[model samples]
Target chain A: MSEFEALDFYLMDELLSDEQRLIRDTVRQFVTEKCLPIIEEHQAAGTFPTDLIGPVAELGMLGANLPEEYGCAGLESSTYGIMMQELERGDSGLRSFVSVQGALCMYPIFEFGSEEQRREWLPRMASGEVIGCFGLTEPDAGSDPGAMRTTAVKDGDDWIINGVKMWITNGTMAKIAIIWAQTDDGIRGFVVPTDLPGFQAIEVKGKYSLRASDTAELVLEDVCVPGDALLPKSGGLRSPLMCLNQARYGIAWGGIGAAQACFDEALRYAKARITFGKPVAQTQLVQELLTEIASEITKAQTLCWRLGELKDAGRARPEQISMAKRNNIEMARNTARRCREILGGNGILDEYQAFRHMVNLESVYTYEGTHQIHTLIVGNALTGLPAFG
Target chain B: MRIAVCMKAVVDSQARIELDGDGNLRQDQLRFEVNEYDLYAVEEAIRLAESDEGHVTVISAGTADAVQGLRKGLAMGAADAIHVDCDPDDLDASGVAAVLAAALHDGGYDLVLAGVESDDLGGSQVGVLLAEALGYASTTLVVGTNEPVDGAMQVRRELEGGEHANVQVQFPAVLTIQSGINEPRYPSLKGIMAAKRKDLAVKGLADLGFDGAPARRVESLGLTIPPPRELARMLEGGAEETAAELVRILREEEKAL
Candidate 1:
């Protein structure tokens, strides 16, 4: 693949600070040198690239937006968003790994876990020495996490957790699982060590989308953990939903990366591919497809930059995040499809990335509070009416 | 051990180069990075100075904006940096060497390292000129170096035609590093955060006891891109005719008979 020409139609690069651009370029180089070369083989084999964990950790990518006191990079939220943009520009699987590790796993521990817990796990997780998976979505609960049946009951000084978390990224590789389960008071989070006797992680096979990522089913049969395992600050379903908001923010920017990747590949291919005695790029229909993809990417990029700004100011609402997630992901899904069309038959081949990103965007569209769920969340915010009922 | 690595800030290799109407490089859109070859010198200096009581300082003479390049060296584990504030374009290779030599003369450095040549100008003169000014022995195209023993170091110099010569040099020697001498590491996040706190002292021409004008022994006339060559012509017709045509073209047009 050719080097990605950043499709910044709006010249958004000028708005970023020097440090932010430096971090973004660093990650872009890392993905190009380390990830892009081997991702296709891993994607074809349906295996995650485990070797990248060290390099990623060495870059302080895991929990990068968290505080430096906890061994994170302590970067601005916009920088974190840009990092996700560059990571997903290579592949969604690579972005998913960082998202789960940083936003979902490390965020909760920093926000809800006790200082002891944070002291115990955050540093190791930041170094990639200890991998973690967030267990919130259940087999029965997809859009509605409140409907989850997983429960953590008090037994003496310990808590016994029993439930099955489905479609958990980094599940099989995690040494600790941030399992959210129902308690007598409400839904609370437990930093459950995977080595507990009744806990088991089974790799979910046959996944066509996100093939380069690990998805597993985590089964807990009376998994017992000490009292310190429970995140005392966690109150209800709102706690896990907050972590989703963080991850969703990153995915909002990530959507732009995937779309840009497809656009770059498609545009390059169209310029070189000849049809009807001229390059396909000269055709009116091909130009229209390219225009549509570029326009959508620009809109999504501007939206993500604004969202990142709002998040850094701490004024961002969940509904605002919902809007970005819903809009950008849908835009990416459409962009990937159009880019794939422009590639013609070669799009299906592994040598090309459009089809791969197109398939991966399908999974992205469904996860992190599905496209429909975010639609209702935005709709409810606008109309002042509950539509989920 | 105290070591100094001479680094230069050049235009990023991947960025498009555009010249102005005055035949000078358009500076507005250019992004500057540490010169590619200097990264090897910086890496080697850092590796050799890993023990306690060992320090590596990166020094560069360029415009104030070159601080970004110096900061990169700091992020790569340099203890500190010295930036000679001036436009590099205003100085030729001799002038450039004078500025660096003035900055490093009394710094008590045991070893001074630099790249064999810069990417943009390819002068390949700064290292030797700097050594002459500082009154130190100099060698170029250094591929490998062993630890200092009894105040002298053994180094392998790349020779022409796949040969290398090992030589011994005393303390305070200058070595112009080759690119493949070592692989430069990307700045870790920890190193980057720590770089903000590291010392990067800026020196004016007067601070180095000069009257703000370096000795410009050479000047650039102009720069132009060479004309593009004609596209290759394919021979027509089958074996015998094309062979005869190739011979005729080579003998008559190309004058290679």
Candidate 2:
């Protein structure tokens, strides 16, 4: 197998520290040697490779950007972004597991939970001894989570949560779910243990995309927990939105990984696959496709790296993240499609990664705030007007 | 105990090596990595250090690029690194050994480890020469090492034709390691972070009390790709006829039945 060389047309490596480069190279090697070998089989069977959790955690990838006080790696944001890029290069499914565990689940607890809550969950989750999922989207509230009907009613010292969550990544496999519900004050976050009496997580079946990931629907029929389960600092929809921003930031970098994977596979196939009288790589049209994809990947990489720097500096804006999430995912989707075309009939085969990445990009394009939602966010930022009604 | 691992940076064997018009390697295009056998040596040093509460210091002789290999060794749990700032191409085996011996001479290390041979040169002379320079007893083709018993280290040496011998050497000895001693672990993230904080001392030939000139130099004569082997012949006929032809070739043409 040809090694996946990350496109660094902008010399982005010059901006990274030695530690960051080491982390990136280590994770890239891990993904190339470990994840890529079994990803296809898992995707074919539509099963998540649970055996990888230990190895992934051993790399300190779970909550890697978080502080080391709670057993995390405490790496810089750019290093975290590079790790996401490498993981997604192997498979979007693998990256999704990390994104859900780190950005959506662990991050919220670290950012908004009480000291006791943080002390209880962060270390175990970081070690992959316990898996977690974020539950915000509902059956009727896909794009507009404010319309979620999940309710948390006070029953003495306990809050009884009642509702259903949809399209939850890692829902079926998680040991805990960070559920967002409407309380008397506003929407609040609650940590609901999956083993609770009234909580149920059923695996969603027949997903054509992101086949190697575990997506599920969570049902809470009066799931009761002590008042301590509520994230004391979380109030209103902004809390979940903050978590989505973290995940979306990772998605921006991850989109480039998928694009790089497709581009690398297509480039290899073009040189080896012969048509007519010569290799297809010699054809002008094929070369144009390669050039365009390479150009877009470089641009996307620059955007993600700059955003990572801004994030590390605590100067990044959510709208800027929206722009990157929107632009990079679109670029990756388009690149995957073009790379698929470049591979011709062989593109549809599972042996080639372009088709698999092309399909996975569809889910990545839609999740963590859809492409349309992100476009509106950027549009609202650019023009001083609210476009969403 | 303190262990010193002598490492070398060599071009990746799988990389495409190109020769320039002057018959010199196109070094700019080739990807250089830590010598494969040398990695086993480094791993063994780290293992020995970890179990004995000792320290491992990796030393490499090359230009600034050789620091990459040293950093990799550090990331794999070495305590520290020393970069001998000299272009590897400017020295022969003895000259390289001289530089290494100089760096190791005053370090007060109990043991010195090196690969049996580097992947690029395949010259199995450096360890023996380094032993001669440092006045230390030496063993080559070492497959394993036992804990020190009675101030002496017991090492298993792989002999020719699948044979092995156990030899014991006193402290301050040089051992050249063969590959497959153990599976080298990838650098963990914590180890990588720790490596960033560890000291990487850069030393020059003058610091080692030697002039920049080498005692011996190696000059390449030429380079060529080995000739491809002949393709196998295919016999075409009925199964019985093909089988008969095969038997005839093995019995008559080969003079064996």
Candidate 3:
């Protein structure tokens, strides 16, 4: 029951008001029932649970932490983590779907969009009527997005955008993309309609990790955007990094959920499957592995709880997210391996699900910011040195 | 229409539980969670409210400790909640059922649902007894449901092993939901915040008009941990040898290959 382990550390329950527990439990239930069943199948099909959009919206998951009105769910940062943890408990790909759509895409528009623009798009996005995607990483410029070749030029009352984005989640199906491109004003975001005359998206196939997630390559050529489509207040590399920061925080909690699921599966398998005439649970090594994995999960939970508090309090900086992103995700990857060991041969199969989880952990390890990228971010924060070349 | 759901505050059943000295459950050492199976009931109630013209209320028959579990239900869109507020030592499922029945009567809910059993206890009797106490037709393991007419209702019940049976019963009937009836919705942040002030209905024994009545006796409950396995048993062998040993063990020793 590593997955179901009611985590209470450092009197965390007392720290959370009654409302926090309620929210966490509600998300927990939704993850267990809704996401867990169909997640594997969707991954196999290389498609998304499009039907889930309405349900997710109804649960107020989309733009959930945004303010009330405009049909927003109006939760706080930690509450968003609650959603991520539960969603990723089913599959990291599914959680990534929400994080990209909500945190990476809608958030920038909400933060920097013109009032008229907000009034137009926020409600529709909130209602799941129009799905959104963020375009930041490009084929040529990935970790260093400041070097992006994608460009937008000003024309009277509009911006002509031309570029390609790689590894875009929800790209193929999204009706909107909050794309970042170099303008004369430097890197700026535009809430471009994907159906624009020259915009194209095709699903990215052949991924061993996050297979359940729909990632696509976005090609925008001479895509014209009205003045209203641009996020006017945002400028500089800071714009997209801010979005990445939000997504990373959610990933911090989400990675732990995946680890917990694997730990739970392994722990159960070890106890029930007898080896050499006795239950494997009785073995010290098996117990040791289980113990280590669960402890890692608990530690990750405690770290995320603190991170959530820091984020909700508005004291969280990029390095705080980077530290957690680096540590928790690697912790998840390690825990998945340990759990995979516990299941032995059954671990390799999809139904038992440890191997897929292990595989998915690899994608999680690389996305948003790779482990090395987060490490450099933290290193730079500590020494006041920029490590990324 | 008004609906009520009975729930338990169980340690996440998937959580690893350890016992303390002198035979009491060391919940302090264990990871705490809302009972897993009960969540299906909470989700169903939420869906029902969303679909119909009804209000859903949740009630649990435990003390301050049970508050978290009730809040979890409330956050899943239950309109209100109540806690019987009793000690954890109270053992009788019937006693728990009695408190729930009292809450049901007081709340005036037209329909009630419960998970067929607590994941920890798997006691599939509480809903049945509560239904009897309230004088309503009760069914367990409902897998599907239909709209309730003014006074009558219909539900699809899951029978033994992949089979299903549908039945209609009158108002005030109790139907226990089976797992996977519907994917339970997570509590929206709005639901979570709203659940905060929704009245826990905390009451003492006198308020429910009962003082420790029992349907069954507790005859010593304890957990036993099997002896640890010896370290020498784990063999370090190559794949072929491992497979041969596994097959031999599975066939000759355990009598199943």
- How would you order the candidates by TM-score, starting with the best? 1, 2, 3
Query: Each candidate's DockQ score against the native complex?
Result: 0.45, 0.52, 0.44
Per-residue CA lDDT of candidate 2, range B1-257, in tens? 89999999888776788888777788777867788888899999999988889999999999876887888899898999999999877788999999999999999988999999999879998999999999999999999999887768999999998799999999889999999998887787767877888999998999989877476656658666657888887999999999999999999998888
Can you tell me which runs of candidate 2 are displaced by over 4 Å? B13-15, B160-164, B221-257
The TM-scores of chain A alone, one per candidate, are 0.99, 0.99, 0.96
* Candidate 1 lDDT tens digits, B49-135: 985468999999998667777787888899999999988878999898999999999999889999988887788899999999999
TM-score of each: 0.93, 0.93, 0.78
For candidate 2, list the clashing residue pairs, or say none. none
Query: Docking category for candidate 3?
Result: acceptable
Better of 2 and 3 by DockQ: 2
Inter-residue clash pairs, candidate 3 = A1-B14, A6-B32, A43-A212
Query: In model 2 chain A, where is the ten-residue run with the lowest total lDDT?
Result: A1-10
Q: Write the per-residue lDDT of candidate 3 for residues A189-307, one digit (tens) a residue.
A: 99999988999998988887888888999999999999988899889999899999999999998988788778777767887898999989899999888777777777888888889
lDDT of each: 0.91, 0.90, 0.82
**Off by more than 4 A, model 3:** A1-29, A32-45, A49-51, A269-298, A338-347, B2-52, B88-189, B207-257
